[model samples]
Target chain A: MTAPAAAPPFHRPGDLGEALRLLAAHPEAVPVAGGTDLMVAVNYRLTRPAAMLDLTRIGELRAWSDAGDAIRIGSGVPYTRIVAELATVLPGLAAAARTVGSPQIRNRGTLGGNLATASPAGDGHPPLLATGADIEIASTRGTRTVPVAAFFTGPKRSVLQPGELITSVIVPKAAGPQQFLKVGTRNAMVIAVCSLAVALDLETRRLGTGIGSAGPTPLTAPEADLIELPWTRPGLFNDALAEEFGRRVAAAARPIDDVRGTAAYRRHALAVCAARALRRVWTAAHGTESTR
Target chain B: MKVEMRIDGEAAVADVDRPGESLLSTLRDRLGLYGTKNACEQGECGSCTVLLDGDPVCSCLVATAQCEGREVKTVVGAVPRPVRDAFIACGAVQCGFCTPGLLVSVADLLAREGDPRDPVIREALAGNLCRCTGYEKIIDAVHAAAEAMADEAHRAPARSRAAGSTEETP
Candidate 1:
């Protein structure tokens, strides 16, 4: 592995001001929280920032709060924290967080890093997208909250500008009965070939779905509108509707074959996750979401 | 950067150049605690497992800077006598490469859970992949160790009572 060039003078910024100042001075510098994803990039020579701003020490981005209707998750909060702290309020996100890498990865990998990397296959994306979450981005100038749906521009690309940092992701507590499922080469510590996150609101009888790793960005399946799912069938999902869901989910993905799995496999996996996700929603509608 | 970490209850200081530098590097190269083997510099292998503040994490993925001012227990200092004896009795040590890490992980689990089931033990050792022995003996050793520890805990009060009576007579 190509070692990161003696990380241009380590600077431990004390506060947001110091952090912005450092970022402004070093335009090519990278901001890292958890350092799980960035370290891999640095090692692989995929990313070479002139300097790195260690955000783990920053107090502002490490605090989480459940304020009224929405729950705000600090970008610095680790996956382990998601499982341990927010699982009850945010089960979908917690379940997705648990599936990220192993216990060690879950301990160090943060939702912020996952979002910043913006991999379509990122475990956190679909869940956040389904929640209609908003990301708070801060820089020296000011802070602005962008809807999670508009956060991604393309594959591994985000709307975030230089010198900007994601402070927190705000998700609504009353989203619905949410579920996240992913198909990987292995059960753990493997990247997702295809993944699905779906949420159903019994109060409104509405369903929202998000598909990942099958497209440039996570696709919000218009299952409720474009596809005629037998929502009234109750308990049993019609095979046609299920197949239609799978087909729509596959159509939404733009996967390219790689060593991890082929494009065909990814497409099939996307269909499977989409079908399983529909069944999961049906089951939750009837009883409870089973533990994996 | 100068990082201060507690290795086996002793304070250690080392200067690392980058944020991605692994704890395994510092332990093996700088602190000379070679017991924590480095494998799959990525976290896919458990050869670098170590207890960071009592939780088992892959040392290769942990930034040495993160461990600054934190307690780090490597395999060399983490394994207890009972755990070692159980491994010997169960013939769990095979190939000798993966033993230290596996032992450290199991020890941490047992210390936390008292007596872990086979599945719990398997999950604890999931990251630490063993090519030899097929993991049967290692799992058996962990089960044996937990039972042994539980028996000792049960008898401790009785032994103390006997000692108290003897002292009173004297």
Candidate 2:
């Protein structure tokens, strides 16, 4: 007599087509990949869906393949595999994956789940932003690719539409060294206070910086200085420039005070992380001071 | 919903009656396999840890229906004798609440990684938390188990094969 009469149907689709059809039919369904986030909500009674679209059985969603100039990582690929398999190419993302949670969580938690949850503190977001990754989203109707920077609309919110599922993410292979750094109360299994990811492309002389936790959404610094940084010139990648990059990256965030950290703390931490990340990537991409 | 799966090297079908019940609850309440603990319904704690098709995952976070036709190995029949002996020898069981999960996790580590260093051991056990916080002893047990298993492998290839076959049983 207390709870609603609707017992949600559990649809475990074995393939992408079946999953998309289920989503199309039950657009109100909550799509679950790794069940890392959805199961928590189910356990806590946070959200009661009309139906549950389980995407784990879809084999295509659990694989990665090579796109033209990039690697298309399936949305359902677990973090453990990324850390093990993609480290050489997606070094920044792999670093973030290593810092995600414990070994168990990494075995189950996924990048697509993080993006679908769209938490401001999702570790995968920063690296995707830094690598200029594109999110490939799909539905029964069609599919579309959105840049990771345009994916999030707000905290725990995304541009994902009704009946849509994240299929994969396309990240350009690391043309140069990449680095990701995070600040937490303690290292293991802690939510990010703030995190930063930096990628410098030697071929294109492009520098990308992403900020996490200290923002309404995972964001890019987008400063003209960062865009105009002389990445090819090793001497220019000094502490002063890196510090300014850190400051601008911090400024780009629209952080609010929360249980994990205060807004001021997040801003300060982001700046420090960003500066250190820049120096790390610069050194890895170019050379040590002695070598240069 | 009735799910048919291989649990602990046995074929069985479990009846899941709840709307959103986890594999942990189904195992404890329906199937009566209570070796896995039920703390922290969230995936943060590894108390309800089980091997879902040989990969350690929080059973509390797994839908019972989704485990259909897949393998699930829990602490009851999965933990090797040497691992348990090492745990007892090292005094890793304090209060005994987190032991089963820790045992399963440690067994997994020993099986997958024959020799793990201190940091790797710590990182592997990071998800399983002991409220009693006897982590030093647990680390000692993991090292001891690894060495014992290696010794067993060295001593009798046949016994080691049997253990491996039992774990890898389809």
Candidate 3:
């Protein structure tokens, strides 16, 4: 019988540069932030890496900056901090963060960790996709950015290269009303059965849609994006149009039968969440216009 | 691997046997600070909750070495009095297995919010699961603790009560 791989070497780099150097030197080192996902993997013996790069001590990755039109949230910034500090600017993301695990999980789980985990069911993905966010990835070689929509390659997978560490998530400021809702069996601390995020850019008349846990990876709905909204119309909302948009968003899912939910239930839940999210965002955006 | 951190304002060092030991294991095994419970070694259970630099987190998910030079407040040395008293008064203790972690989490919550409402209290305790109580009494304990603390604050805002002095029923 084969023996288990030896426990991975551990490094606690204090800065991003040092972390990048360690990652570059040891490409197989799994970067751990908050340990919300990675620690679970380690505990379950699901993943055994050659080394573990601890990013908790990196002060640079915990500071968010106002980057002109967008916010550059440091990869190590906890969900609790994001909810407390950035809720106004990144409402959808903050809303999603609020629904994550619980007080303790939110206190520790970082957005970068969520993005790195790349779970189809990760609560952070839908909001990032809805806001047209970009992920800033770094290595000793240099740094590069990937659009959030294009970052996920498959289930629990991303475009992150070996030796690269996620530095920050560049989330565009919410331009209009945004709504995020997740369906779950319990009220809190439960993973989403399925989730949806909708953001409407009133000025551009563009609708952004994100669906979670219904696909191979966190998915965005292109057809739903192109849906026609009659901003100039008297009532400003078409129930049938919104319902059709929900259907289109549901069509985008490649759901599978998982323990949390069946594909058919996921599809149904996605459609409901999609339609409700659309109506909520549209109404809210229009409310802003009328109040103005 | 030797991991060093301050627990409840005192420095502690754990000479860990496993190369990748969790802070939970280090606390429960090496240092014998079993106040942080150890059910569901994964991040799911809040039984191993502790304050990492004033923020409550599951110790099971924290790698021991990563806590170097940081501050941790487990239920052992940092138990809050009002929360503990209120837990007993409200009969919140059921199996008693979830008490220590629940106390730590509630202390953190009450520190953040003095008078948390039902929904807020419910939201705060959601991570610390109790199969026996079904959460109603736990919610009551949070309210009672908040009220008691608030009244104490009015009476003596400057009073500095020592933490962890109240005997916890094991």
For each candidate, what's the DockQ? 0.38, 0.57, 0.54
Model 3 error, position B148 (Å): 2.1
Candidate 3 docking quality: incorrect, acceptable, medium or high: medium
Provide the TM-score for each candidate, comma-separated: 0.88, 0.93, 0.93
lDDT of 1 by residue, A86-164 (tens): 9888878888987888766776788899989998889999888876789999888899999989999999899999989
lDDT of 2 by residue, A1-292 (tens): 9887554477889999888988887777778767888888988998766567777898998999887679999999999999999998899999999998787788888999999999989999998998899999999889999999999999899999998999999999998888899888766888898898888888888888888888788888888225456544666657777778878887888888999888898888888877777777777766756222
Which is superior by TM-score, 2 or 3? 2
What's the candidate order when arranged by decreasing DockQ? 2, 3, 1
Which ranges in model 1 have alpha carbons more than 4 Å from their true place? Answer: A1-8, A14-17, A44-50, A223-237, A287-292, B157-170
lDDT of 2 at B55: 91
Order of the predicted models by TM-score, top scorer first = 2, 3, 1
Residue B60 in model 1: shift from native, Å?
1.8
What TM-score is obtained for chain B in each of the predicted models?
0.88, 0.90, 0.89
Mark the regions of model 3 whose C-alpha exceeds 4 Å error after superposition: A1-8, A288-292, B17-19, B157-170
Tell me what fraction of the real C-alpha contacts between chains A and B each candidate also makes. 0.18, 0.55, 0.68
Among the numbered candidates, top TM-score falls to 2
Residue B63 CA displacement from its true place in model 3, Å: 0.4
lDDT of 3 by residue, A173-205 (tens): 889989889999887888888999988877677
Better of 1 and 3 by lDDT: 3
Q: How many angstroms is residue A121 displaced in model 3 relative to the true structure, after the best TM-score fit?
A: 0.7
lDDT of each: 0.79, 0.86, 0.86
